[model samples]
Target chain A: MPPRIAQIRLVSSHPQVYAPCDDSFALVDALLADRTKLLDHHPSICMEIGSGSGYVITSLALILGSESKNAHYFATDLNPHATEVTRQTLEAHGVHAELLTTNIASGLEKRLSGMVDLMVINPPYVPTPEDEVGSSGLSSAWAGGENGRSVIDKILPVADNLLSEKGWLYMLFLADNDPLQICLQMRDKGFGAKIIVQRSTEEETLHVIKFWRDPDIQIEGNEAVSGGKTAPQRGFDFLRSQISRLSFRETRQ
Target chain B: MRLLTHNMLASNIKGVTNGFPLRIEPEKIIEKPVDFNPDFLKNMFSKIDWKALADASKIMGYAELPDEVPEQTVVESDEFLRKFHHALLEVHLEEGALVCPETGRRFPVNKGIPNMLLHEDEV
Candidate 1:
């Protein structure tokens, strides 16, 4: 017998934000995938931005246990309705999570700067032209605008602002969204970026990218810090190099 | 509110970057006795911000966190597991205040409920 699929109703004001077919199940799979990777590192602080239904954070909270490494999971979504659903789901699972309803990168500086150790994002990355910015334009969750970099443009600068030294940033982007540009942008911000995983479908492409420090700077052979810890001095030098390059670009622009 | 919630929140208002790990300034905190679920506790091990939770727990007057997370050998110990369980799930944020780190806006919690409501001016 095949495994039975559970039909769970996920009520969202922006239903168009998610894939129309079996979103709940897709969410579960995404959660599991995220969980496996997160558990592999077991980061001290984890933040999930654009947590659509709270599945990833809730599932992480449930499976990782409250005590293991004294972990805390924060899930944020722009939609309040989605946040409410996330809160309900965690409560039902007897798991705890902090749910925030706000726009991407808003208010985070005042609250979380220099504190987070890991960040995960699955933003709207499909390219949309400037003229199309309304309901008929495209899915706000999937459309990335013109060059397919609008949301990434917004998020990258924030990642630079919020990510702690030696912290890791993970994101998923579509092939149409210009992964190379995204990588270049992150690298320009002084973060070492690489595609950790990818899955291509007939109509779309998905790639998971991990952004961190240059491997040389990481603390080698240290399993506790996920391979190695990037020293602050090297990180500063990298940042300086990036700033110099930016200044050169500014001179040209 | 619990540090778990604090870890995930961000200021998402337009033009403000760096929304993450919302800061917590607890005016009042209460530890309500929640039924212990070890399975649930065990399952949540990976998702936590350990240092933040431990720091917050200490601030709230419960300081049993070991210097480092013990090896798997000690994970099954009843004493070790119980201490971990109480710190994470048992403590409740009954009444307090959560202030956004960036904007300094205050969201009050009355009766275990955090009123994250924003005014028209805020929106």
Candidate 2:
């Protein structure tokens, strides 16, 4: 049978490279859940930041499949080893992506700014000591120091700059990382956020949030507070209500 | 790395502005077969930086693309799309180094991957 996503056997491994895990699966599932939306999105430039094994990005390309022929795929990793492994994985699936080894995306921001139409991330959401956040190799994969927001916070601004006016970003966030707060943060950036998929394993709970630019929502602090701007207020209300429901459900669990 | 990737890459060292179209120091250039899709090329034609792509193509030893950014109507032609597709996807940089324009930093490319990581000082 043909593989819907990437075959695990074909995924290259290194002692230091991070492997595909539950968070990765949940992230893919979130993309799969929104396959039709992705197809309709018609993203021309697609990218994945912190691409460990290239599983999520590869799966995303597959979900959109050959129908999305115009979309150019790019993946970046801090670890050079992860970039090599990612190349092998993309090749195994007969897909092509421009791979770069960099911290988040420092060098290419100018060229890529406001251009990426679809972006995905399976960030290091594991809360560790502050010292471990940017450690080299495998530890960098899951070390999210101090509520797991170190890398997440850094990525948010970059993602904001990279996303097109119609762009969509899918990212995995742990409950500990605080999904509600993340959603609110995105809301402040004039993006509408919703959890498309939420899964819990023995280790940790994962929420895969899909964010898109909502014109109705005003960018925080940029627009003056006005009672007449009910449309943007309603937009915030929607995000707040949706995320609050998630927190309530989690508390029940 | 293909010329398409090159068209979108720029140096991001601190205090370095206009770090685009990093100069190519090609060591091994190879052509890899890519599935041809004219529609994809047409869409990308709008997004890509024509001057950088043409310059990079010339550097990689393919000179089919025009020097100036052609009109969007030109992208509709099959001949134009073919050249656009070839320069964008077919040519690959199997091994080389991308030299940053602002700072003479060399980011090595091996096995078709570009290491854009900056050194501690560069960062």
Candidate 3:
């Protein structure tokens, strides 16, 4: 028989904060496998929103450090307990990062606005009814409201405001969820969104979805960033030209 | 949650219908390194909906797939196996949201975690 996936005990002060489930772990592993290619080049500032136990972000920091040396990750979570856990995890891994406790797109807005090169967020997209409000503590960490877009709706506007012109935003969501709508929202806000990874299972258990975005509203050819220039800025220029080309096409049409 | 699981998850709330392929509105999408096991990939071949996986992968900015899938026999081909490996095993979404099609519900993924909670009215 195949070896059972070893469950890692999540060290958290509040037991309510759940560790990443199996599928989540697998998704994270797959995304981080090719860190260099995914970022498209080097990113100066990388931020992870709602970092749980810091498993994924810390791993990313380590990989980025080893590969790019100049890249730095700033991770945040609403829960102080979770943030502390992430700090400890980063310390244990010998990876350096700036950890903070803030609600989604809170006080850090000014600090991060238009300065981030890459922003990674895994917000609560699950739809929760008002009656289920009692389950708020842990649930709040994950609940997305009636339409599941509550947090997303709030975040997108902020993401639009905060993201550097060429910055990339990566996210994970369920397919059963309305990713297209979110895509439309991103596009409407002049951001380009794409589904970068997907996993399907025979088991009827829960599924996870992931998405990525950039402000340049155009798909880029593999303009690999090898020199000292930041990937986001390069991507921004490429995307702008592409968008202009599309507009030119539309006008001709 | 795995893309497999995301494909299966739906909001079966009282009045809502057509819940499939939950949307991902991730706050962060990180890709962590994982050990590649060919045997595991082979075993999962039969269970996957290749078209869906391919389409989704393209949406995520990976477009190195062939138009038609090779025969199951081709699993041994080094080239074919490499493509499959990258498609199914390597991509990751560190942050984002998943929205329901019928009810338009959203589920958040933070760090690398997804929250599948439903509301009382939703139930």
lDDT of each: 0.59, 0.87, 0.56
TM-score of chain A of each: 0.68, 0.92, 0.71
Which candidate model has the greater lDDT, 1 or 2?
2
TM-score (chain B) for candidate 1 is 0.73
lDDT per residue as tens, model 1, A217-250: 3343433344444564444555445444544544
User: Candidate 2, residues A4-50: lDDT per residue as tens digits?
Assistant: 88778888889899999888888888888888889998998899999
DockQ of each: 0.16, 0.81, 0.02
Error of 2 at B92 (Å): 0.8
Better model by TM-score: candidate 2 vs candidate 3: 2
Where does model 3 sit among the CAPRI classes? Answer: incorrect
lDDT for each residue of candidate 3 in A178-243, tens digit (9 for 90 to 100): 565566556545565434454444531222223345434433344534565555445445544544
Cα RMSD (Å) between model 2 and the true structure?
2.2
Kindly give the number of clashing pairs for every candidate.
Answer: 35, 0, 81
Higher-TM-score candidate of 1 and 3: 1
Superior candidate under DockQ, 2 versus 3 = 2
Ten-residue region with minimum lDDT total, candidate 1 chain A: A2-11
lDDT of 1 at A152: 76
DockQ of candidate 1 (2 decimals): 0.16
